[model samples]
Target: MLGSIPDLLRLLAVPVFGWAAYRDIETRRVPNRTWAPLAVLGVVLLLWDTYAVVTGPTSGRLFFVQVAISLGFVAPLAYGFWLIGGFGGADAKAFMLVAVLFPAYPTYYLQTTALPLEPSLVGVFSLTILSNTVLAGVVYPLGVAAGNLVRGRFSWAMFLGKPVAVERLPEEYGRLLEDADGFTRSGLDLDALRMYLQWRGASLSELRAAPDAHRNPDSLPADPNPPGDGSVVTDGGVPASGSPDQFGTAGTADPWGAERFLDDVEGSAYGTDPETLRAGLELLADADEVWVSPGIPFLVPMFVGLVAALVYGDVLYALLSALGLA
Candidate 1:
C-alpha cells in the first residue's frame, strides 16, 4: 500500500502534463497558478515518502538518496537553464516540479513485464525525463527538414525556418529570420509585436490603416515618465522613428507603430531593445516575405518525455548501453 502511493502520484502527472502541453500549443504563456496545486501536492508527497523511508527497512535509504540527488542536482540545473535562456519560465518550473514529484522511478507492472524497461544507473527520475525530452525534441527538426525537402525548397536555413509572407507575420508565432543586417538566427520575436498590439488595444491592421496617426508622438496619450535612457529618444527630443540607419530616426516611416510601441511600453520590448524592435519593424514593413522559425512547443516534448521516462526509463541511457558506451 505504501509503495502504491508513489505510483499513483506519478500517474497524476500524466494528465497535468498533457493539459499543460495543450495550453502551451494554444498560447505560449502558462499561468504560474497552474503549478501551485501540483507544487503543494509534491511537497506533501515528499514528506510522506521521507517518513515512510525513515521507518522502513535499511534498503529504503536508497530512495532518500535519490530524492536528495534530484532536489540538489536537477532543481539547480533547471534554474540555471532558465537563467541562461535555454528554458522558458514555465519549462524551468515544470522540470523543477518533476524533480520534486518523481525523485526516484516508481515501480509498476505491465502484465507480465515490469515497467521502466530500462532504468538509469544514477536513478534520478527527473534527469531521465530531461534526457528523453531532448531525444524526443530531435523529431521536430527532422520533420521540418523532411517537409522542406518534399516541397523542393532546399536551403541551409530549411532546418531553422520557412518562408512566410510579411503581411501574415502578425498572425504567426516565432522569430523572423531577416533583420536589418539580414539572415540572423537570433532574430526579432513576434511576441513583442503581440504584446505591443495588446497594450495599445489595437490590431496590426488598425495600425497599418492609419500609420501616421499611430506613429505621431502627439497622436497618442503623453507618457508621464518617458524613458530617460536616450535609447528611444533622439537628439531632437522626439522618439526615434526607424530611419535608414540601424536605429531609425523620426523621419523614417513606421507603419507598424514599432517606435511608438517601444516608447509607450515600459522595460525592454518583450526581450528585445528599442533599436532592434524598430529596425526589425522597418524590415517587416518593407519586405514582401521573410523566413520565420516556428519555435517548438517544448511542453509537447516534455509531456512525451514524462511518458517515456515512466514507461521506458532513460532512453538515452538505454541507447548508450545498447551501444556499449554505458
Candidate 2:
C-alpha cells in the first residue's frame, strides 16, 4: 500500500503537465506558480519514498541507488540544456521535477502484463523520458518539411520557417529570418514585440497606422499604462514587469516600448536582443513579407514523452534494441 501511494501520486503530474502543454501551445508561456505546488508535493513524496526504501528490506536498496542516479544524471542534464539555450527555463524545471517525482520507475500492472514494456537498462526513468521527448520532437520538423514540399517551396529554410505577409506577422508566433543586418538564422523574436505592445497598451494596427508616430523615443508621449505596482500581462501570459527594477532606467516614452522590454527581458529568454528588435521593426516597416519560424512548443512533445515513458519506458532504447545496435 505504501509503494502504491507513490505510483498513484505520480499520476497527478499527468494532468498538470497536460495543462502546461496546452498553455505552452496557446501562449508559449507557463507561469512559475504552475510548478510551485507540484515542486512541494514532489519533494514530500520523494522524502516519504526514501524513508520507505531505507526502512524496508535490503533488497529495496537498489531503488535508492536508482533514485540517486536519476537525480545525478537528470539534474545536470536539465541544467546543462538550460545553460546552453537548448531548453527553456520552464522545460528545465519540468525535467527536474520529473527527476524528483519519479526517480525510479513506478510499477503498474494491467491484467496479465506489466506496464513499461521496456525498462531503462541504467534504471534511470527520467533519462527515458528525456529520450522519448527528443524522439517525439523530431516529428514536427519532418511535418514542416513535408508541408513546404507540398507547397512547392524548396529551400533549406523551409524546414525552419515559412514565409508570411508582414501585415500578418504580428498575429503570428515565432521569429523573423530578417534582422537589421540582413538574413540570419538568429531572427528577431515576435514575443518581444508582443511584450512591448502589451506594456504600452498599444495594438499592432496602431503601429501600422502611424509607424512614424511611435518610431522615435524623443517624440513619443509618456506611457499610458506604465509598469508600476501592477503587472503588465503580455500576449504570452508572462508578466511584463514584476518590479520596476526589471526595467532599469528604460524610459517609458519610447513609442516602440522596445527599450524597456529589451531591458527587462533576457536575450536568452526570448531569443532576441535590442539590435534584433530595432532591426526587425525596420524590416516590418519596409518589407512586404518575411520568413518566420514557428518554433515548436516544447512542452507538447514533453507531455507526449512523459506518457510514452510511463507506458513504453525508454523508446530510443527499444528502437536501438530492435535495430540490434544495443
Candidate 3:
C-alpha cells in the first residue's frame, strides 16, 4: 500500500501552504525568497505524480485520471467566480494547487457493484471540507466577537496591528469622543453617524486592496438603540444573536446602503446579506461593515463529490441522478 502510490506529498500541501500564509500574515510580505522553495517543491511533486501515476502503470494512469477528473469538476464553479469577480488571481491559483495535489483520494468500489456506489469515497475529503468550513465560520465570528468586546465592553482581544476605522470628523469630532462619554443622552447626531459611515466606507475600500487590512485592532460598536449597548437583543433584552466577535464576511460596501444597517453593501452599504450583517454587527454595531471580495464559503461537497465521482464514475453519476442534477 505504500509503494509510491501517494502518501507524503498529498498531505504536505496543507501544512506547507498554511505555514506560508501564517508567515505572510505576520510579515505583511510573502517574499520571493520564501515562495521560491515552495515553487520548486510544487514543481517536483507535479513531476513525481506525472511519472509515477501517469506513465508508470495502470493505477498510475488512474491517479493522473483522478487529478484530471477532480480539476474538471471545479471548472464550472471557477468560471462562475471568474465572471463574478469573486476571486482574485491568488485565490484561483491556491485552489488549483489544492486540486493538483489531492486529486481523487478515496478509493471507490467498482467490481462488486451491488448497489450503485453503495460505498462512497466521501470520507477524507468530506471531513476536511467540513472542518475547513466550520473553521472559517468560527474565525470570522470570533474576530467580530473581539470587536464587540471593544465596542461594548472595552476589551482589546482582537488587536492585530492593522488599521482601525478612523472617524472622519469635522476636525473636532475626535476631541468629542475623548470625553469618555461621547454619545450619551444627547443622542448620536447625524453628523457623527455620517462620519462613521464615511470612515467605514474608506476602511472597506482599503480592505479590498488588501484583504488582511483589518487584521489588527478589530472592534464592533454597541447597538445604537435607546439603551445603546453593543448588543443585538430581542424585545425582552436577551442577546439577539451570538455576541462577542472579531468578525464572514464578504460583500461590497463601496456605495453604502439604504439606511446602511441591515441592507446590501453592493458596491455600497456593505453589500446586504443578513449573515454578513450579523458578522459585521458583531464587529462594530453602529458603524457599517462591508466585504471586499465575494468568495462564498468553501463547500466540502465540491471536493468530496469530485473525488468519489472520479474514483467510481458510475457512483458519481448515480449521485447526480438522485439529486436530479443529471
Candidate 2 error regions (>4 Å): 1-3, 180-182, 198-202, 209-215, 224-271
lDDT of each: 0.74, 0.74, 0.37
What lDDT tens digits, residue by residue, belong to model 1 across residues 1-326?
A: 23376567668889988999998886666789988888988889888888877887766868878998999999999999999888889999999999999898888876678778789998888889989999999988898888888988776568887888876766677887778677787777887765655544445555556665556434443322333321211122323322222233455565444555665665565477666666676666557778888888789899999999887889999899889999
Candidate 2 global Cα RMSD: 5.4
Q: Per-residue lDDT tens digits of candidate 2, residues 156-260?
A: 578888888976765677888766566678777776666566555555556667777557554333433432222223343423322223222234544454665
TM-scores, all models, native as reference: 0.83, 0.81, 0.37
Each prediction's Cα RMSD? 7.0, 5.4, 16.6
Model 3 per-residue lDDT tens digits across residues 258-283: 23333222222212343333233233
Q: Ten-residue segment with the worst summed lDDT in candidate 2?
A: 240-249
Name every residue pair that clashes in candidate 2.
none
Question: Which scores better on TM-score, 1 or 3?
Answer: 1
Number of the candidate with higher lDDT, 1 or 3: 1
Q: Which stretches of candidate 1 lie above 4 Å from their native place?
A: 1-3, 199-203, 206-260
Query: Is candidate 2 or 3 superior in TM-score?
Result: 2
Model 1 residue pairs with clashes = 242-248, 243-248, 243-249
Scored by TM-score, the top model is 1
